[model samples]
Structures are given as structure tokens and as C-alpha cells.
Target: MTNRPLPRSFTHVDTWVFDLDNTLYPHHVNLWQQVDARIRDYVSAYLKVSPEEAFRIQKDYYRRYGTTMRGMMTEHGVKADDFLTYVHAIDHSPLEPNPAMGAAIAELPGRKLILTNGSRDHAREVLARLGIATQFEAVFDIIAAELEPKPALKTYRRFLDLHGVDPARAAMFEDLARNLTVPHDLGMTTVLVVPDGTKSVVREDWELEGRDAAHVDHVTDDLTGFLQRLLPKR
Candidate 1:
């Protein structure tokens, strides 16, 4: 948690784009697991499959089609909005307000925005829990991206167009390093937020080396500390 100067390349950044979920709140909260189980249930009940089978297909579809929701839409004709609402219906009580994080975020010098594959409602809930809803200029969610999830080039292009953001002058922060590829290719400095103690999430072989990818600009286990370091001196 050292507070230090950021790389010189970051000095040109004027917009800060962050991913929600594990990027905003620490993964230790296990809130995502609740949504994950709900998705499994939805898939199981819809397809009449066992929960085990549903979970398998859920992950498979998630990997194949960017999101299980997208795969369900493509394969099962599931309604995107409905699926989002169902999956995100879990209790967000595990999350507590993070005023320190909110304060550190306020110290950042740029227009802030959240880019997520989640629904706006869920994003609102989480941000409210973190007590930082007003800090963001906007949230670009799945519906906002026309249901196109992240890691998808078109979604990134659409978001950039809609926000009038200059890729070269913006920075993208995400928990998944792979999600940073498009942003990095689009000329944004990418930071991977892998907060301490959540390393076990890299279950897949590819995920194992994501932080080593060329598109990954930096890795930090402490996001607030990272932001604090990047803040300009008063």
C-alpha cells in the first residue's frame, strides 16, 4: 500500500473507467457467489437440468458467449433483462459502506465511470452500499451496451462513442485482466485489480497467466492503495 507516483504514461489520463463487482468491492465479500448460484438455479429450472449440469453449462456458456445470460439469450431465448434481474436478486447485505474507498476515489483527478456486465440496478445497489454512487458520471452496463458484454470489441467501441471518450487519454481498471485487452489495444493504460487473498479465482489455465499478458499495464492487490498512490499531490 505504498503511496507513490504513477507511471509517466498515466499522466495523460483524464478519464478513469472502472469495472464493478470484484473491482469495486473486494472479492472476499462472496456477493458474486450468490449471483453465481442464482444463475445456476435459473438455468437449472429453465432447462430442466440438474443443478450440477446447469452449473456446468452456465460456466461453459459464460466462457463461450461472453456471458451465461448472452448464451441463454442465444440458445434458450431467455430475456436478458429478466435474467439479469433474477441473477442479481441476491442480498447485497454482505457489502458494507467503504467510506475510505469512496474518499480515495474522490481524490482521483478525472471523470469517473463504471463499466460493468451487470445490470444498472445491481450496480446502483453496490455503489450505494459502498456510498459512492454520485462519484461516477455514468455506468455502462450490459443493457446500456445493447446486451453486448465486455471483452467484446463492439461494446468497447460503442461505449467509447457514446461517452465521447478518448481511448488514449483514459485508463481502464478491471479485476479480470482479459477484459483489459480491448482497452489496452485501444490505447488506454490497463490496471488489473487482484486484491490480496483472491488469487484462487484463476481456476482456468488462461486465467492463470492473465497478469502476465502484454496488454496488462499493472497489477495491484490493493485498489484503494493504488488510487491513493496515483493521486496527485495537493
Candidate 2:
């Protein structure tokens, strides 16, 4: 199989959207694992279930519903704010500052935004750790999306509408390939950020689906390098 050329020019893109967690930072950091544990704890306490049962429920919800929060909200009437607050309260110390990524994002030609299934506070904390908090114009979080997670067409539509973004002139970067489908369908360029092979990273089997699918226009392991490569030579 031949390697396809990455879209060298994003000059046409006016809105640059990025997913918060694994998309912005390397997955090897294990920051998400902390959040995952907190989510399981939350589920266990809220449902009064065993730890093992909560673990199962957490994974099940993620598979059935785009996010565990959404599934819990639909089935158990869980409050999104409470769940979000608890799950995102994990220590962010594992994430190191990336000035290179900040510079790369700062050089991108348009309105930068974070479109995350996570809460705004979580996004802000992660961005601050990445040293790129000031790069984004706004964060469109789960609360703003009314608890609708990514991979949902309605959520993507809402984000586009709320930001007055023209799909044809926008670009989205995310770690999960399935989450890019709606953006691809909406006519935005979709990039999938995969784990760099240097470290042993653990992820659910379902999370690995559609990685090489048609919806992904580009794929990269080093997000900062990829972003820098997209810039016009100075």
C-alpha cells in the first residue's frame, strides 16, 4: 500500500478544532487513566454497585452511548455536572508543558477551538498544562453540547452552528477515528491522532476501531510535528 500525502495546506480552513484529551497530549502520559479510574469510582458510588460491576458498566456505557456520561444520564438520570466534576478532578500533574505544541498551534491560520466531550474546566486545566490555554478562542464542552458526546451528528451540528463555522472551511483533529465520521460527513477535514509506537499504551478495543477508515483524511502520531508541517514555510 502506498502512503498518501498529508494535506500540506490548511489555508482554506478558517476554523481549527481539536479534541482535548489524547488528541492534544500523548496517550503514554496516563493522564486519562486517572480520569478513567475516577469515572469508575463515580459509577460505583452512584449505582451502589461493586467495583467490578462499575468497571463493566463504565465500558458498556462508552460502547453503547458515545460516552459513559451520556449513557448514565439516559439510563440512571445521572447529573452531567456532578459526573463531570468528579471524573475530571484527577491530578493533571502527569501532563508536561509542551511549548512546541503551543507555538505550532499559535501559528495556525484561524480561529482555534477545543471541541471536547469533557467539561470546560477539564479542557482549561489540560490546556493550561500544555501551555496553550491562550491559543483557543473558546471551548465547546459537553455541557454546552447539552451532554451530547462526539460521534453524534447533532453535537457536531451544534458546534458548527454555535461557532458560525463553515464545515467546508474547517478542520478537526481527534484521537478517536469514529469521532471524526460526523465531521467528515459534514465536509470538514478530519485528522486522527494515534499513539506513537514508542510506549506501551493501553486502550479499549472499541477505541481502536475505524483508525484506517475512510473518514480520516490524515493520521499522525506526533501532533506537534504534524501541525508544524502544515504551516507555510517562513
Q: Best candidate per TM-score, number?
A: 2
10 residues in a row with least lDDT, candidate 1? 199-208
| Candidate 1 global lDDT | 0.87
Which residue pairs clash within candidate 2? none
Candidate 2 Cα errors over 4 Å, as ranges: 1-9
Local distance difference test, each candidate: 0.87, 0.90
For residues 79-127, could you state the per-residue lDDT of candidate 2 as single tens digits?
9888988999889988889999999999999899999999999999999
Would you give me the overall lDDT of model 2?
0.90
Tens-digit lDDT track of model 1 for 1-234: 744435326889999999998889886676888999999999999999999999999999988888899999999999987898899998999899988788888888789999999999999999998899989999999999999899899999999999999999999999888899999989999998874874445234444357767788888888888888888788
Count of backbone clashes for each model? 0, 0
Model 1, residue 207: distance off in Å is 4.6
